[model samples]
Target: MKIGDPLNRSTDHGPQNHKAHLDKLLEFCQMGIKEGATLVYGGKQVQRPGFFFEPTVFTDVQDHMYIAKEESFGPIMIVSKFKTGEVDDVLRRANATEYGLASGVFTRDISKALYVSERLNAGTVFINTYNKTDVATPFGGFKQSGFGKDLGQEALNEYLKTKAVTIEY
Candidate 1:
């Protein structure tokens, strides 16, 4: 789903499912923190009842690090600042990972956005937005992230078999 709304960021102790999911997410987040990514925010789990966790952010993340390279699949975000004119740097960092399911480009320059969009080795690219989704769009990852597309018309092709029809004319 496209995550346009403001996320809890921290573990939501108010909800049971939120706590459970946040707990698993915490493990992944801390792993990244330990690996050297800066913990910009939300590093600790709430001591009170429920699965309340702090909303965490990581900065100064290196591209080679496990946290920066892997998909956290959580509320955590690792941000790396880049120069104003150097879009290529960000593109390289974003495309450096093994997983290439989707990516986002935020810029005012249309040409730069298009250039990065075209150069990025991902199946899906969104300009100026992150985690945007559509019912008609296909979603999946490349390399070790796994194979096959989910949702949309591409989903129908997953179980389909191609047959060659031959006739003597």
Candidate 2:
């Protein structure tokens, strides 16, 4: 297995709340996995002896699939290809989802990287890293993914309300 192989399932698995439609999630993953995407890691319903999944990856995934549109909580990744010099294509695909949490752009071209970082429609855009977090940075989801910021100093502001009191002196 590689350093980030999907087959290396986490042992801390358990029943998750079906707040986001489990059937839809499964369907999305299946559609992507079936469309030439290799299931390298996770696609199991039950852990059996342990709460672990196969940790899967789907390479060569096709666009317009549900997996590409939705977010998977497990260790499932879909690697898709786009035309060279077609940054717009990637941008469109990346922004097609209702969820806008975090995104990353990896490239040597500084201009292209900056452009993508500015236009990804995500709350946090990392130029060359995914899941880079900081206590001083604001974090939140957009659209159906939910709202309200968390982390950093700004987190406290979200839970606060301001009021102006009038007094006659």
TM-score of each: 0.67, 0.70
lDDT of 2 by residue, 110-164 (tens): 8888988888888777776666577889898777666778998878988789999
Question: What is the C-alpha lDDT profile of model 1 across 1-169, one tens digit per residue?
Answer: 2122235544232322576677677776778778777787776665666555565678888777777777755556567766767777878778778777666677788887898889987778889877668778988777766688988999889989999999998
In candidate 2, which residue pairs clash?
Answer: 6-41, 6-55, 40-57, 41-54, 41-55, 41-56, 41-57, 42-55, 42-56
- Under the 3 Å rule for N, CA and C atoms, how many clashes does model 2 have? 9
lDDT of 2 at 138: 87
Minimal lDDT window, size 10, model 2: 1-10
TM-score top scorer: 2
Candidate 1 lDDT: 0.71
Displacement of residue 132 (Cα, Å) in model 2 is 2.7
TM-score of 2: 0.70
- Pairs of residues clashing in candidate 1: 11-53, 41-56, 42-55
List the candidate 1 regions with Cα displacement exceeding 4 Å. 1-24, 40-56, 167-169
Cand. 1 TM to true fold: 0.67
